[model samples]
Target: MGEIWIIGATGRAGRNISAGLRAGGHRIVLVGRNAQRLAEAAATIEASGGVPPRTLVTDDPLAEIAAGRPDVVVNTVGPFGTTTVPTAQACVVAGSHYVDLANEFQPVRSLLEMDSAARAAGSTLVTGAGFGTLANEALVYELCAGRPSPIRVRVAAMPVVDGLGPAVLASVVDAAATGGLIYRDGRLVRTRLGAHLRRIPLPDGTTRATVAVPTGELEAALRGSGAGDVIATSSEVPTGRMARAALPIVGAILRVEALRRTVIRLIDRWQLTPPATPGEVSWAYASAEWEGGETRQAWLQTGEGYAFTSRVAAMVAARLAEGDARPGAFTPGALFGADLARSAGATITLDSTTKDLR
Candidate 1:
């Protein structure tokens, strides 16, 4: 089997993915800056009856990737706005397949723009290989499978994570710094952060509130459904009226480079207490409206958010390592289709009366 290298192996997502890959009988190398933490993570995997993984201690992971050229590289670092391009470029140069858990707009868009380069290099690059992008993008693909391009599309990501690490919080801050974005008439348009608030009907018949945010799901939905107008909302963001009103101002303030950096540094140091898990079920919802009053909607249901993310990232990396993916840059759903979500333990429901698609 080809060797898989996991960057940020000391982090939660990285550790989980490394363990998962190991359990699948794949060779994995754990890379991180802190030798002790990397060893600790590796030891935990070893304790689980898996072969002890090789540990690479390095602050310059990109340089290592460029020189060593592992068969596949899994990046769990964030905010991916800074990590994604450099790491992915290194992988492309080394002809190594790459996967990441990025869901932010700019990084996802920037990575997709490298599709031609990746294809030319014969390197497969999969971004947004986590709950946020794949879950919703799969629904959009299923909802619009055999139809003409939808006139409008909306996707909502409502993940129920057990807890969050500091890196997750930092990514949230980075995303807020990017302001708001949507697709209007097939063109990317800027709008106020938290601009459109909607109460989404859930499969369980309850309504959950979501607000517009500049997530990668926006781009994924646009491309998946071929919709001229698209908006991506999330239950992760503040949806209350007061919070909604303040989002634009907060977004504007964070857009200042220095302030954004400072806020991220403070967030790292604060070491927030993990919040209570929201609920047992996480959901991704999508609704498409075509010309002449035709509409279709769908939902994807899964377990805890982080567990699903770890499974998705590990599965993508494993497939890439095994030569199951094409040589190009893509979001997970676009590359492997909606079955990728099903393989990662998500069930899709096309409508109220329809049976779940396993």
Candidate 2:
């Protein structure tokens, strides 16, 4: 297999993806800003019985990609709003397939806009390999497969993560700055942040409050299901009544570019991260309704959020390294089909009343 270079190799997602790729028998190249940290991660990989991945320490990851010219680049760095376009462009220039754990709508759409360039360069660019987008998008694709355009689609991501890194928190702040977004009437629509809130069902026979956020799953669900109205939400965001009520104000404050940058810097400087409470599983829910009233719903069940993300990213990167992907920019589901989620350790269960298209 071709060498896979993982940017941000010292981060949680990067390390997990490296381990996963190693387990799949793929050679890895760990790239990070700190040589000692990169070496530590490489040692962990070696301890796992995989060959020690080559390490590269560089302040400019894109420069490293351009110079080293790895066959595939798995970018786990964020906020993707700043990194996705530049890294993807570099991948195109380097004739390297690119994949990222981008969940924000802006970055996802930005990457898709590079489809022609990626195709021209004969490289594949995939976004939203993480649980925040993939599991829900995959469920939407399966629920609407073989059906005509759907009138409405709803997707909710509920990840159970052991912990979150400062980068994850920074990404969330960046996404909030983009304001509210959705797909409605076959077009992009904007709304007040947290304009829609609902209690969504889960695989464990329970319900959790979810608030509509501008997640990449909105775009992916719309593309996969051809739905006129789509709402992508997540339990990862604060969903309490007060939190919902304050979302618009918070969003407005962050929308200012300078303020957004300041908040992100503060988060980074403080090393702010979400709590790490282990959970048994993570779940994603999707429901689609056709114009004629035919409806289908599905629940995707998987293990912890980071582990699932690692597997998904590794699978996509390994496939691209093995020449198994097409030369275009795509979401994971649109590119490889929903079944890819199953191969990455996600279990899909359709509603009993929904038609069995499989």
Candidate 3:
């Protein structure tokens, strides 16, 4: 069995990932800062018929990772803007495979910048192994493969989750603080926080209003599709008229370092409940406009977001542990293939009448 270390093991995403790994027959080591919480997590896993993962309590996760030298390390901590770089660096030094569920543009871009280092170390470093990047990135990859680069591309992530935890909320705040970004003229460019509002079409012919956001998918879609202009949106973010008008003001407040931290702390203390499950199915949509005046669109349908994330992360970890990965930083769809999501209960659909991008 492969030996896997999951940092932030006591957190919701971490626990789910741990369970998925354990179910895949991997040996898990639950790593957390809190000893008591680590033990509790282990006990819960054990009660669910999984062998109790070895519990590691540590304030210094990097030291622990270097010491343990696990075959693979999965980081579930966020706001990934703060955690991804250091953790990836540690994994590179430790010569261990690295994977994270980062969805923010900064962290995803930062981790990808470590490709050279990771390759030199003969280690695989993968970022954005979650719904935030994977579903849309995969679609874009599929659409652009065996074709010329598209002139314009748009991707939207619409997740339906039962609930969210403090970490998810914090990550959103962190992204807001970073403000909106897009790929234009073959470069990352800035935009207003709530700009580019549109009603994105779903798999079942329905539509949801989406708002421009600085998500990892923006980078992923651009890189994967070789597109010059790309915009990433999300249904989770508010897209109403009032919300759009207020975004600039709210974004301004969040841009300050101290103010951002204070807002995050206040939000954490408030412990807001995330939007309720939108529906049984979550959809990720991608549309591309080719240079020749042709356009194509597609959708990837999956179960609730958290459950899908667990599967995606586990699958990537298992692949890496089995030596099915290359030495470099990559998004899951880039490292594996567009079909990776389908293996985890995802179904893809293209417009029946038009020339589909499949």
Candidate 4:
């Protein structure tokens, strides 16, 4: 097994992914800002009967990564809106395959913009190695492939299993910073995050307000999957009486920079974003509407959130590193075929609602 570096190792997703890889007998080099945290993550893996991976602590990120030269690097960094290109740049120079749980689209666009350099370095760059884009688009493709129709992909996140944590909060902040982007006019388009609230019915026969969040990988997926339109979102409907009353006020609070800062600071101070006990949750689905043909959909639901996505990314990285796969810049959606995406254990729902073209 070659040296595999796990950046942001202390992160929930990182630790979980690293643990899974270690258990699979791969050598891991854990990297993180906090030495103590990295040690704990390594120990946790070891305690779980996994091979304890080597660890590295760094205050200066890119330089440290440059010196490591691992076979592959799995990035668990969040809020990709504020990106440091050197991280990806150095990985390419180091001849390391790059994978990231990048939920934000702008940085991914920027990273893909470096196709020339990445290919020149003979490095593989795969982003949205997480649940956000790859799983969604992959499943959608599985359902709608070979069927001709303008499709719409929509996702509603339920706070269960791993629940929403700070990383998710950071993701929200990143989306806010960039407003939102969607597939419109047969191209990528931007809109406000809180704008365009639409009510979507859940499986439980209840409805919720869904708002677009661009920090997700949906736009890149729209282009990648060749879908007419793709909309990624979070459920913003008030859950309870108190939440219902607080809806407008909560949006107002998030809008104020100071309030947003205070809320995030409080979460940090309390470590409120760390995942609690994970439950069965998901990041999957594809809804298709057709004019005169069968409309199809696919769904991918994981029993666990951080753990599943992490393990998936780690396995993908290992494949790319160990002569198991090819080297090139790509997204997970672009990595495998429709069948492979389904075998990856994401729940796919295929809907065929057609209007007779009589």
Candidate 2 per-residue C-alpha lDDT over 272-356 given as tens digits, one digit per residue, 9 for 90 to 100: 9977645788889988876555777889999898888988999999999998989999999889988899999989999834542
Best by TM-score: 1
**lDDT values of the candidates?**
0.91, 0.88, 0.88, 0.64
* Model 3 misplacement above 4 A: 269-273, 352-358
Shift in Å, residue 260, candidate 4: 7.2
Off by over 4 Å in 1: 273-277, 352-358
Which prediction has more favorable lDDT, 2 or 4? 2
Using Cα atoms with residue i matched to residue i, what is each candidate's TM-score against the true structure? 0.97, 0.96, 0.96, 0.81
- For model 4, residues 1-358, the per-residue Cα lDDT tens digits are 6778888788777877787778778888898889898888888888877456789888766787688788888877765544425677888888877888776767777777766888888888877676666666676566656756454555444323445556656655545556556776467786654544555544445555555666445655565556566676654233444544454445555668777777666766675653454345554545555544555544565655555567568768777767665556677777665444455565555545453211
lDDT of 2: 0.88
- Most lDDT-accurate candidate: 1
Candidate 1 residue 315 C-alpha distance from true site, Å? 0.3
Candidate 2 regions exceeding 4 Å error are: 352-358
lDDT, candidate 2, at 337: 88
lDDT of 3 by residue, 13-99 (tens): 889988888877888899988999999999988988956789988999998877878889999988899899999999999999999
RMSD to the hidden true structure, all candidates: 2.9, 2.5, 2.1, 4.1
Model 1: per-residue lDDT, tens digit, 155-200? 9999998897877778888898899899999999999899888888
Better of 1 and 2 by TM-score: 1
